[model samples]
Target: MFDHVVFGVSDYAASKAFFLKALEPLGVMLVSEGPLGIELCRPDSQSSLCIRRVEAKATHLHLAFTAESRGQVEAFYRAALEAGGEDNGAPGLRPQYHANYYAAFVIGPDGHNIEAVCHQAEG
Candidate 1:
């Protein structure tokens, strides 16, 4: 039901860097870029991630990324912190989001809510 997702950021350079580092672990790459936004794509997929600079929206936006494992989720959280992201939530299981929903949330450079999640029983 979705063709693509476009996130509005305050600074293109900062948001671009943040996304590059945060999504690198997922095998996503920036395929194209322009003044409007940077287009990203999976290693061999057509779908894209388009990030652009825009006036901050009144409504908060939340984006969730799937991690290959819990470890990746933790790494993403750490990387986000290292990249100057404000901590929203630490990597851990959250029954509220869902049973065995191990995830982490970070405030992106654009001030948008970003999340990395792993949905698997922790055993």
Candidate 2:
């Protein structure tokens, strides 16, 4: 449970564009922008992810966003790939984590492991 997470991207424009498009299904929107960078989050959520321009290599990290349903996870996976993200894992169950854990993973523009997951059983 973080209020926000900040990270650097080698290509600011590319990484920013990738996240904005890829996270559309999750309702993430640009919240603010400043000299520091840009902040993005869903309108109703206080948490956000901020991307800043940097020349050094980005430190890779896994970031996961909760999905309201399995459909959102599927949508996010497709959108992320179309937005130039590399597929780390396709949308599917990861019963090892939990009986109803369904998720999709993608390597983002900055090599961050981005994921969307739903913990509910399929209807």
Worst 10 residues of 2 by lDDT: 1-10
Q: Candidates' lDDT values, in order? A: 0.83, 0.93
**Which structure among the candidates has the greatest TM-score?**
2
lDDT of 2 by residue, 42-72 (tens): 9999898899988998998898999999999
Q: What's the TM-score of every candidate structure? A: 0.87, 0.96
How many backbone clashes does every candidate have? 0, 0
Question: Considering every candidate listed, which one attains the maximal lDDT?
Answer: 2
- What is the alpha-carbon lDDT for the whole of candidate 1? 0.83
**Model 1, range 1-123, lDDT digits (tens) per residue?**
455788677777788898888877666788988879899878777677798777754246898887878988988888888887899999998998788899999998767788999998764
